[model samples]
Target: MQNQSFLAMEDPLDALCHHFSLTKALLPPNARIPPTFDMTLSAPPSRQPTHLFAILPPEDNARVPTLMIPVSAGLYGQSFAADLLPAGTALPVPHIQNGNGAQPPCVTLPVVPVSAPHSLSIPLVLLFGLGLETDRNLLAQRMLPAQVIGEFPHFPAMVGVMAKLPEQQFEWYLGYTHGMWKNVLALAPKDAGLVEFVQMAHKVIVEAGRLRGRR
Candidate 1:
């Protein structure tokens, strides 16, 4: 009997790819892989140190830490600023320091800023909520990409596209993983290694689609 169950589902990207046997054909050539880049999003490359800075706690004795997420230099910067940042500002979060010798009850760190080619526009910053004094070790490892994806809509959707490929299509699989890494890095300040990844992955996606079209 034909497998009619999967056809009934709303999202057929994964299932449909599996139903067909074209997964292996879509894999990129091993020699075509870039030497400086790694497909897994496990860690930032040697030169491209990951940018994860602690954002000040919102409330007194709060138990969370918010971090900065930057964007790339492009025309879309304004769109990002207008869509995300709070009103009347270039930088979304303001500096927080107590007048007295003691620490302020709440701290607000500046949102990650980008020097794009775009014109002056409203401020754009996104503040993530993290409780105070959390363990750095625990947070880094325990936090799933899904959790981070939940917080930000932009990269998640792009990553969603890559997730549709079958397991045998290692090329596309790597592309998907690396694409997500590039997407995350694009949001942060310019890192040379990451910049390389973004350019390469963008080309990979475009080329992959072309290959699929010709087949």
Candidate 2:
């Protein structure tokens, strides 16, 4: 794996051009475009790029900043003001496990409704990273709660795994949603054991759900 992260840190435009085929010539003249790393999730090969606009809150409506998001097919992006989540919702927090003084590996937060008469059709992308063995383990544990919550009505969500290749200096992302896995950018490592990890996650989640139901 070649580290591509350095490319962005050194010359972002060059990185974008090399990776996504985006170029300065594609933009308007005298555009003050800043360097940015495209972290948008992967989409199907047949999909086309789409523009997305943010839905701002009343307080920030006075000075809405120009935002550009590259969206793929079957995806929509929206934003809302921060507010309290519904009562009885479990808030994800870091918990020390096994009394080993080790911090929590992962935290799963609830995707609460932001608008009145909320629609569940909106797909939710859950972002996660794989860097350390602890992270993988934590991801397995956290996935159980994520799957459990996904069963609830009015929440359509999927897991997006972000794998950083320090050697390559770039990132790779894959998504699992609607009963399928999709690669966003580059392919994951053959030895990453992602399939085994996902299988074990599902098994543990099922067993945990069974135990909870027995209670």
lDDT of 2 by residue, 55-137 (tens): 12223233423222222212222221122233432323212122224532221112221221111111111112111122343
Clashing pairs in 1: 62-132, 63-131, 63-132, 64-130, 64-131, 64-132, 65-130, 70-187, 70-188, 71-187
Instruction: Give the candidate number with the greatest lDDT.
Output: 1
Lowest lDDT 10-mer window, candidate 2?
117-126
Number of clashes in every candidate structure? 10, 7
* Top of the candidates by TM-score: 1
TM accuracy, model 2: 0.22
Question: What lDDT does the true structure give each of the candidates?
Answer: 0.29, 0.26
Can you write out model 1's per-residue Cα lDDT over 1-215, one digit (the tens) per residue?
32332223312222222232111111122222111111122212111211212222234423432222222212223322232333443433222333344532222333322222211100111111111112222222212233333433354443444344444563543444343444344344233443343344454445444544565
Segments of candidate 2 deviating more than 4 angstroms: 2-192
Give candidate 1's TM-score.
0.23
The 10 consecutive residues of candidate 1 with the worst lDDT sum are 119-128
The local distance difference test score of model 2 is 0.26
